[model samples]
Target: MYIPDIYKNENQEEIQNFIHENSFAILVNQTDGKLWATHIPLILDKNEAGKDILVGHVSKENPQAGSFSENAEVLAIFSGPHTYVSSSWYDHENVPTWNYLAAHIYGKVKVLNHDEAVGSLKKLVDKYEKKSKTPLRVEDLSKKTMMQACGIIAFEIEITSVEAVKKLSQNRDKKNYDNIISELENIGDLNSKQMADEMRKNK
Candidate 1:
């Protein structure tokens, strides 16, 4: 979250899009004087007051679930494509580094009631199931399936601040930047290809 001026992305719309694309987030909070973390898929949505909030759930068995409270602060991290950037790709001598995009969101946590949780679940299921051959829905689930929800705790976080960083070789000159993209594409891994594509967009 310590983003340099050159790498800091203050574009709220872009940051929101990135969060939606990389919705699987690392949720962190303090528990018993120690930090607790959970990796889960969270969706961005607005609360009844029309403010931005993130919705997600954790299993009741998860110790982190018990830590959620109305006033507790939590952090959610959304990570994007990234890969190693070898100095060999740069024309001038330099050390290897990694290029990536990430967003850190800080918010106040609040546990949601059953009805609100169901509403959130409906939205989550509808969004992800859109691309499926046979889209299923929360309303369509059987009683047994609904009972499974009892094992989890749904919550929402009112977003207080967000820090987005886009470190896509913005410091490199045109020649080195082009070469870096070329090298990444040539590497041909999924991460490399995606990073190459993002670098081009950043350029």
Candidate 2:
């Protein structure tokens, strides 16, 4: 992430919260002398040592499942809302730019055992199912279905570092910043509204 000083976000709580809100991430690794990426939803956990850990599963049929070892290093990218910022929103002349929030997490991958893998799957199911009008719990799955799910591979990533960015026009002057926010809010799309809210919070 090529983040300018103005856009750099060093707030740990904000970064973690962003990760939690955008848990669906892109997991990237190197395999067979080539780079591979997988899109998946990860659950964040904190260890007794207060270190961040990420848990997720990969389909057995996916070749990336075998791309990692016990201590292999990998990256997970968690991206929040983003939108285009028009130069016209600025009080003075400026070029168009983008405003967004994102976190790049680097970690060491640790493959989980069969029981742990099953637990990870259950946790994911429970998290998303709660939003349903009539929640369907993972435990409701039939024995055969559970058996079939065993084919998935589960792993944990022990977080090493985090690089986060919040490009919400912090580099602009107050008048321009306010203008940008107002324009974004008026646009009314989800991404634009999100950018506007972030700008207001940061301001």
Q: Per-residue alpha-carbon lDDT of model 1 for 87-115, expressed as tens digits?
A: 99988899999999999999998898888
Error of 1 at 30 (Å): 0.6
Clashing pairs in 2: none
| Worst 10-residue lDDT window, candidate 1 | 63-72
In model 1, which regions exceed 4 Å deviation? none
Candidate 2 C-alpha lDDT tens digits along 141-163: 88888897778889999998889
C-alpha lDDT of all candidate models, in order: 0.92, 0.88
lDDT of 1 at 140: 92
